[model samples]
Target: MIKNIIFDFGDIFINLDKIKFANELQKLGISQNDNTFTPILNEYEMGLISTEDFINYFKEKLQVSSHEIKKAWNCILLDFPIERLKFIKKLAKQNKHRLFLLSNTNDLHISWIQNNWGMDLYNEFKTCFEKFYLSHEIHLRKPNNNIYQFVLTENNLQANETLFIDDTEENTSAAAMLGIHTWNLIPKKEDVVDLFTKNHI
Candidate 1:
């Protein structure tokens, strides 16, 4: 019996366009092969660096304006379907299982979401969770054992009674290693609204 559920924010609840984001970055002379990019991005996502410093680093290195950098950085975020919101709202209202949101996200993206969704809608989505853990705020990111351990330990949740849903296999695999149930959902084809029917949860 799954008593607790952990959900990934991107591609699980909100849509993401990783390829488009990468292409935009490539146009900006940044690529996956750029050795310096990933570490700093990881640091930014882990909250090890301030947003100002992050923007400054890119501004100096890419010789681009802060606005351009922000625009490109946020290109990965697509949209949040209303049905998913309705589904989560209903699930949260039932109070059948403790809910949590764990995502690898940063300040800029979150700011965009807050602005786009408005405080009321964002709060509506946020209130659905018992705890909302953003990687930057928590200083922890996914596909990492520590993050999963922290969530479980902090909530006093048993691994067997918890189910984690993520769009990435790597993240789900890591959770599975900790004895937590997981569903590595495929986006587009698999909508979270069909959670109970599709996953038979």
Candidate 2:
């Protein structure tokens, strides 16, 4: 009996273009093969650093302009399908279960989403969730036990009664370890709208 649902935002909702982002970064001199920025990225996602500091790090290291850095960083974000919105909206209206959105996102990407989608649509999507959790806002990132624990404890939810859906195996696996049900949804091949038929909930 699943009574709560947790969803991830990136590939699960809004599309992301990793290869395009990588190509953009390469233009700014960060090689696709490089893992040097992973720690800083994690830190930024966890709200450990400010956006200015994040941009400055790249500016100083690569001697690139802030505009270029921001452009490269934001290029990964793509469209949010209308059907998914309709699906979530209908689900929210039914009020059958508590809904949540948990994503490992940074300031720049979220800001771009707000600017691109505009506030009305953004709010429409946001208001569908009982609790909306962003990594930067929550100071927590997924695949770590504590973040999931925080959401469960804060919501007074039992792990066994919650279903977490994410596009990443690493994230879903971490949630599963805590006894929560999870769907490691494939991006293009699978869609969130098929939750009932696919997850058999």
Clashing pairs in 1: none
lDDT (Cα, tens digit) per residue for candidate 2, span 1-201: 999999999988899898899999998988868789888888999999999999999899999999999989999999999998999999999999999999999999999999999999999999999999999999999999999999999999999999999999999999999999999999889888899986547
> Residue-pair clashes per candidate, as listed?
0, 0
lDDT of residue 144 for candidate 1: 90
lDDT of 1 at 155: 95
Q: How would you encode candidate 1's per-residue C-alpha lDDT over 117-170 as one tens digit per residue?
A: 899999999999999999999999999999999999999999999999999999
Worst 10 residues of 1 by lDDT: 191-200
Candidate lDDT values, in order = 0.94, 0.94
